[model samples]
Every structure is written in C-alpha cells, then in structure tokens.
Target: MLKSLVVMAVSFLLSTAAVAERLKDISTVAGVRSNQLVGYGLVVGLDGTGDKTTFTSATFRNMLNNFGVAIPPNIDPSSKNIAAVAIHTDLPPFAKPGQVIDVTVSTLGDAKSLRGGSLIMSPLKGADGQIYAVAQGNLVVSGFGVEGADGSRLSLNVPSVGRIPGGATVERTVPNAFAQGDSLVLNLNHPDFTTVRRVSETINSLLGPNMAKAVDATSVRVRAPRDPSQRVSFLSVLENLEVQPAQEVAKVIINSRTGTIIIGQNVRVSPVAITHGGMTVAINENIDVNQPNPLAQGETVITPRTGIEVDEGSGHMFEFAPGASLQEIVESVNQVGAAPGDLMAILEALRQAGALKAELVVI
Candidate 1:
C-alpha cells in the first residue's frame, strides 16, 4: 500500500511538470500594456426613460448653445428622451491612429433605461488628461424591463448599460519603451524563483551563455538585436519557446460561503487521530383525558403529557500516518463518511494542532 501511494504521488508530480507552456502564455513584455480611456457624454432617443436631474438639463443647454441655438434661462427643455452617460474603453497596446475600439456606456443618473439611444460625440481621455479617441455610436443594449400600473415590475438583464462595438476611433497612440531599451524584460504572470531560473536557463540554451539573466523572481532580462525588424523576429522566437514552470506551493483552499474545498497535490498531513460525532434530542407532547367512571356529576378533565428522548451517534476515530499524501487524507475522510462541514472542522483542527503541513486558506 505504501509503495503504491508513493508511486501515485510521484506520478502526479511528474504529470504536472510535464505540462510545458509557451513563454507568451506565462510572461508579458515589461513595457507593453493597454491603457484605459474614459469620457462623459449624453445618450439621446430614449422613450420617456431619460434622466431628469438638473445637471442633465444644464448639459443639454450647453450642447444647444454650442450649436448656436441658445435657450432662455427661464425655460427648461425638460427632455425625457435624453440620458447622461459615461463612456469607457481600453486602448490596446500598439493601437494606431484611425483604428476602432469597442466602448461601454452606462447611465449616470436615475434613468430607467438607455435602450434605443445614440451616444453624442465625446472625446475619451487617458490618465495623462490627453484626448486619445472620439466615441459616437448607437448603443446595443441587451437587457429590458417593464412595469405595471400597480407598481409591480419584471426585468431581465440590466437595461441602464450598453456596449458599442468598434464605436471609438483612436486619435492618439500611447508610447512604450519596447524599442528604446538595449535589453528587453519579461515579467512572469506568477513569480517564482525556480521558474525564473528555469526561464533564464532555457533562453541561454537557445542563444548561448550569458545571453539571458534572471533579474529577479519575477523578471528576466534578455539581450536582443538593435535593429527594429530583427528585434521583432528575435522576440517572436523567444516568446514561443516552451518552458516548464515550477510546482505550486502546498495549499488547501476553502470557500467559506460555498462550502467548497480544494486540496493541492503537494498537501501532506502528519500523524494524527480525530473523532467526529453528534448528539440529538427530541421532545413530543401528548394530550390525555380523565373521566369520572362511577360518579355521574363529575366533569371530564384533560391533561398534557410530555416525552423526551436522547440519542448519541456512534463516533468513528480515524488516524493518519506520518507524511500522508493528499489521496490518503481523502480516502480516510471518505471511509469515515464525513460531510463537508465535518471535514472542514477536521481540517481546521489539524491545522491548529500543527498536523496539516500546508497553508490553509479560507476565502
């Protein structure tokens, strides 16, 4: 049994390590990333579902003034077919001028819905407070709602938000350091010293010694060609190289809300014994009648009787051997027929007693 258990554990580790991943899947170029652009705008053509805030009215008056149609201060347009909204989109890395991107529009006021609305021309700005793109398009709302005269309503998905595919045209490009540095840095999605060392070694094996260096646990600096075209080709090859990552640390994850428990393959338990049991008590009430047998004048009376019962379930004791593997722990728990809550208590107790040789995370 012990031999089979060891074999199974070794096989599990071997299988996990055999899964090699492309460098592009595991790491990203240090300076290449997307930027977020945001803007405030107004959506028109709503059917009696527009915002009635003072700010919306002010924005409407300002827009009309821009078109040389001034409105008197004493009169309010009170348009119910317009809604104020916020627009946002992600400017992809290497996005050039005139390229189109998708944008999300959401209402900013008490508007019931933004269905059948068109966004006005709005300038999207980046973190540097510079206009990067212009957004204007009809919205594609997926959700709708309905209300009855009696105040009862039924709704599907949210109707106050919508998306416009390829709605924004890029007008500016965010500069990156991809072409300015002599060496390029690759940042790992997940940092690990062993993984970084292995990545450096793999790159060096392909380009010769001293060509790649592990700068830290999360980054590797690699020498590349100076010419732009040659550098692109060099990076393309490096990003495709296959490298095996190190195994994750031993951990047990518990979702407190959903009662989900996940045990990692590396989790182990020291020798320990545990017992689970519970006691149940039940009480029942019964009504009894008292009657006069010989005396004819006696009145019948009623009384109440109560009965109590106690049951103690048979407790089962389970023991774990020293350096028990994840499979062994699971098998032992199954043998005891422990429920999810019971298993959680057992694991917590083991952690407190220093018998669980892994990190216990309750999320």
Candidate 2:
C-alpha cells in the first residue's frame, strides 16, 4: 500500500499542466519573517532519568540561589529527578507582548527521557543577546522507552525531545521596516526571470504603469502608500492577485537507495535504443565417503565433488522515438520489464550518450 502511494505521488509530480497561483503562494515580503530565539534551561520531575553531569549540578545550585536558598560550597545535590534542557521558539512577525507561542525542549545533558517533566521559567534570547520571551510549561512527550533488568531496552520515537504548545509568552517586539519604507519588495519562493517579470506585469496591470518593477530574477519592487493602514490594505489586494508562474526546468530525480525514480514532465528522450539483461551462476558441492572392506584396515576417506552452471538472461531491447514523452518512456521501460536499478542504469547511459534531454540527479 505504501509503495502504491509513493508511485501515485510520483505520478502527480510528473504532471505538466500550467496553473495560475496567487502571488502570496509564490512570494514573501522582504523583512517580514520569523525570528529564532533560543535559551538554556532545565526540566524537572523525571523518573530517575536525570543528568549526572557536574554542570547540571551547578545549574541547580544557581537556580536555588535565586530562590534565596544557599548550599555549602562543598555540598553537592545528587538528585535523579532533574535534567538540564535547551528551549527554542520562533517569534513570528508582528508578535506583541503577552502573545504565546509554541516551544521545543531538547535534553542538553545525559538525560534518558523528558516525559512527564516540567520546564522551569527560562528566558529566550535572539541573536542580539536580548530577551524576547519567557517559557515555562509541562512538556508533551510523544516517545518513551523501557529498560529490562537484563539490560534489554525498547524505545519508540524520541523521548528526549518534546513540545509545549503556547508555552512562551512574548515580552518584546522585533521591529520591522514594513511601515517605514515607501516601497515593498516581494521575494519569489522559486527564483525565475519569467516569474518575476509576470509578477511585476500583473501588479502594474492592476494598479497603473510604473507601480511595480522587476529588480532581478527573485525580487519585484513595488511602490506602496506610506500610511501603515493603506499599506496593509494594498498588500492584502496584491497578495490575492493571480498570475501564472513559469514552467519548471526539466530534470530527473533518482533515489539510489530506495530504488525510486522521478521523471519530470518536461523530460524527453532523443532517438535511442536500450537493451537490458542479467547473468546468473550456480555452484554445488557434494561429499562422498569411502569405507574399507569389513576385514581391511579401519580407515575411511572422504572425497569432494563440485558442479557449476551458468545462465544468460533474455535481453530485451527497446527504442524511443524522437522527443518521447514521459508516458511513452514509462511504457517502453515497462514493456521490457526493467527493474528500478536497470532503469536507472539505462537513464544514466542515455544521459552519457547525450540522448536524455534533462538533468539527471542521483540521490
């Protein structure tokens, strides 16, 4: 069933029909993106699967000090219920104070699992070393493990990493140039000269001439109203405008390990003939025992016999007409009953011979 689904997905990817897509689906506004914030924190309430590292102990002491509880310099707490962790979350664009976002917690020490653990309040900082949010919540772990007394263990998924939805409360805002600039830049998800030109032309046609211009293959600069409110409304309209994107480049993707082949719709094969076959060799070994006569010396000898056989598989030859389409190529290969590996070899050979009109990518 899984194999059929994979084949179906590949078939879908082979489609060549061009469709009109919304501008928002193909491009993003410049300087409008998520900010990554990370922090080092601790997770507690583990079931004897905590870190034993010295740094974990030190962090525990520091956390206690913040709570007005001091321990002796030489005294060390060896608790098995605490584990150090690292927290990270993305601060979305235009996020305000008190807004909550999801956070991912990963074990930073030698902890076995983070299941049933609670994360302590930790400050998440951006690249500029400024705190942006605070995270504190119970971890939601989807993976766990169990160990036997004889050292055998069973595990499912990853138990050391977890997520806490709406765990971090935003405390700071990352400023952007959305309202300060007179022009906005649209960056294409897939850079192409034709696509950018079409985007600029589409915008110009909607508004007036000289309203949008293509800066390069990946960007389209557009003039906009200076007022923030007008800019927001203007962008809302522009994002929904539909335009047909340029067709993708012709290419072939091959998964060598899984024996999966993906041929793009634009892939074509020049006039070529291919032959595929296989050879097999078999060997057999036999042992024969020779016993002396009843009254003769009591000694037995053994002799070995060997046999070998060879078979040459039936080679099938197929031909591709000039500028063969994807369906024709598939039919030709299927008629020859060629396996994935054989088909990959045939494609590579065609590429080497300059007959395959597409870039062959093996992964």
Candidate of highest TM-score: 2
lDDT of 1 by residue, 209-265 (tens): 999999999999999888888989999999999999988889888877877777787
TM-score of 1: 0.87
Clash pairs, candidate 2, are none
RMSD per candidate (Å) reads 4.6, 2.2
Taking all chains together, the TM-score of candidate 2 against the true structure is: 0.93
Models 1 onward score TM values of 0.87, 0.93
Task: Give per-candidate clash totals.
Answer: 0, 0
Error of 2 at 330 (Å): 1.5
